[model samples]
Target: MTEKQFTIVRELDAPRETVWRAWTDPAIAAQWWHPHGLVTPRDSVHVDLREGGSYAYTMVEEATGDSWPTGGTYLEVREPERLRFTWGNPGDAEGEAPVLTVELRELEGGRTEMIFHVLGIDEDRASEQSVFQGWTEAFEELDDALVAAR
Candidate 1:
């Protein structure tokens, strides 16, 4: 089977460092780590931000109380610039998981351009409630978190 990938490039109204913290700091990540209608409680977030380290979080659907647990190991970590990691169920084999890379570029006026890429999943799995849509909504949540932080 051919592996597929998707990339989301966003211009965020925050600095690269801020964006990096938002991803690496569990406290900050818990604010926006989930898609719309889902909540990632701060207690459910764990981040060990370093090469070979791992991170995990659980997103809960408020209405149904359904929880989705996700985690991954860091393949590469370059603070405020780039991060590459596996993304899948906690404790899953890294080799079998999809890889996600996030590149952050500092833009003019204290803003950032973030390039997010995910590899391994096919298009059919990238449906409305899946990877693509989930991240799209999560990013929107991140934007709100950023604004509130300012």
Candidate 2:
């Protein structure tokens, strides 16, 4: 079976710079990195936005208080345009984890079109769908954060 690859595109009302800042800035990212109902503490968010740099964040479930830590190393970083990174748990070996590529395109009237491509997923369709759903929710939170930041 082939590894799964998926892409999610979102049209955000904010400009590319604002959306980029929300993604690359740790404090801003923590505000909406997780799905709905989960909270990522600002202090727990760390970002080194550059090639070969790394980022990590901890998200706590509101009801269960469970914490999940996610970390990744940057492969390519293009300011306000693109970012490619390896994503997985903090201890994951480099190259063993999945890769995420995000592209931001500035549209007319200050809107931004963002593409999130996830690669190297080895899972069933249902599992992939769940991942997609989670990201959808997270994107919703991201939109809210962008509005609030304005």
Candidate 3:
């Protein structure tokens, strides 16, 4: 089967180190891990931050109390540069889960260019749930979190 993937590129107003922490630190991640209507409680995020380590987070919809538990293993971890991991439910087999890769490049003036790519989701499903839209909104939230940390 053909693998379906999507990539999002954004320039963030923060240093590469700060952007890296936002992705790997549970406390920072909780601030913007979910879509606009959902919330990721700080206590619900776990990050091991190692090549073979696993991480998980739960995004809860406050209005309905619905939660989505996502967990994945780190396939590659290079501090302040790149990360590749599987994206799926807790205990999912790596082979069957989607893969996500994040690449960070330091720019002039303490800025960062982030490239986020994901594979294994079909185009139809991605569109039906507005996955791209959700991530875009989440990135906006991440921007706010980065600014607040400054």
Candidate 4:
């Protein structure tokens, strides 16, 4: 049997533009994209908010002093609406870069629904589980950071 794809969604009470900005801007990403207590030094993150573009960033856990690098290329980008990227850790034993799709839908009363999908990990259930758990916490942290930053 192979691993299965996963989808995660969160309703953020922030405007679409605000949430979009947080994802596309490196400065803002440095502050929020990473998990809480994970420090990504300023000027080390790169983001290109266009189709076919690429980005690379690092995440450092402050307490354990662990550092991990993440990089991926954009497969789709629609401002304030959707983003698709190929995501992978690059050095894992499984060596797969699952496709990550983020769809943002704007709702009335200035809210956005952020839906994230992880695909292409059909042969490694353990990896899928780990990624799912990590992303779950990461999204919650992102929501917290977005609220505070906005």
Candidate 5:
């Protein structure tokens, strides 16, 4: 059965380059990659930050110590503009992963508009609404990180 796809758009007060780094840099990404109440260890994050490169990270639930590992390879990379990659668990068999695309648009006053798209998600496993909520929380943390960096 085919799965559902989702797209989320967020506008940040930071510049495109800054937003790009937040997504591509392992240190910055680990700071905000998980939903609220989850903590990602900096040592568990790895990002190559280049086309054809791969990234892996683990997010642990704060109270339960449950760990969720996600890793994927970069399919396309356009610095400060867009990034396309596979999104899946590290143990998934080859060719069984979905795709995630992130597009960044530069706005006036160094603002950035980011579009996050995920394709081939199993709606039954994770409903669109739930995924949206997770991403929303993650982005909120990302916003805070960006602000703190400035």
Candidate 6:
């Protein structure tokens, strides 16, 4: 995959089960699933978490009273093995938003491999360094979540 629109692989120093829960369980997801310092209020999140399942949550700024809605559908969910989903940013204008798919694989010694492939975005948009930077930060948060969960 090229830098414009490609995959991100991060090896987490945690078991597959722990990492899996962080991605599947709503409570676990909220802990590390957002922009830094954003609060995931109770009852503000729901994750069906399966093939054909849907998920949604709002990121609220306690200091500013701002909330942004985001959601997506699961294309596949293989427990402790893999997860594929249609990642969408509802805040964007209709038809301009992108869709992404993710894959998770297990590694030796209680570690995990996470892969994220963002598709359905324009080449120019996909190539944007800023957007990918967000994904990098998001993955780092995921890493933190794994560590904290353990």
TM-score versus the correct structure, for each prediction: 0.94, 0.93, 0.92, 0.84, 0.90, 0.79
Q: Please give the distance, in angstroms, between residue 101's alpha carbon in candidate 3 and its true position after superposition.
A: 0.5
* RMSD to the hidden true structure, all candidates: 1.6, 1.9, 1.8, 3.4, 2.4, 3.7
Q: Select the stronger candidate by lDDT from 1 and 2.
A: 1
Ranking by lDDT: 1, 3, 2, 5, 4, 6
Q: Given candidate 5, what's the lDDT at residue 52?
A: 85
| Tens digit per residue, CA lDDT, model 3, 52-137 | 99999999999999999998999999998999999878877779998989999999999999999989865343453576777888
| Per-residue alpha-carbon lDDT of candidate 2 for residues 127-146, written as tens digits (9 for 90 to 100) | 53476777788899999899
Candidate 3 has a TM-score of 0.92
- Give residue 96's lDDT in candidate 5 (0 to 100): 79
Q: Write the per-residue lDDT of candidate 1 for residues 23-114, one digit (tens) a residue.
A: 99888899999999999999999988889998999999999999989999999999889999999888777788999999999999999999
Point to the candidate with the largest TM-score: 1
- Stretches of candidate 1 above 4 Å error? 123-126
| Alpha carbon lDDT at 60, candidate 5 | 99
| Backbone clashes in model 5, listed as residue pairs | none
**What's the C-alpha lDDT at position 98 in model 4?**
79
lDDT of 5 by residue, 1-39 (tens): 656788889999999999998998777888998989998
Candidate number that wins on TM-score, 5 or 6: 5
User: In terms of lDDT, which candidate is strongest?
Assistant: 1
Worst 10 residues of 4 by lDDT: 121-130
What clash pairs does model 1 have?
none
lDDT of 6 by residue, 23-45 (tens): 78888787666666466664667
* Model 3 misplaced stretches (Cα beyond 4 Å): 123-128
What TM-score does structure 2 among the candidates reach?
Answer: 0.93
Ten-residue region with minimum lDDT total, candidate 2: 121-130
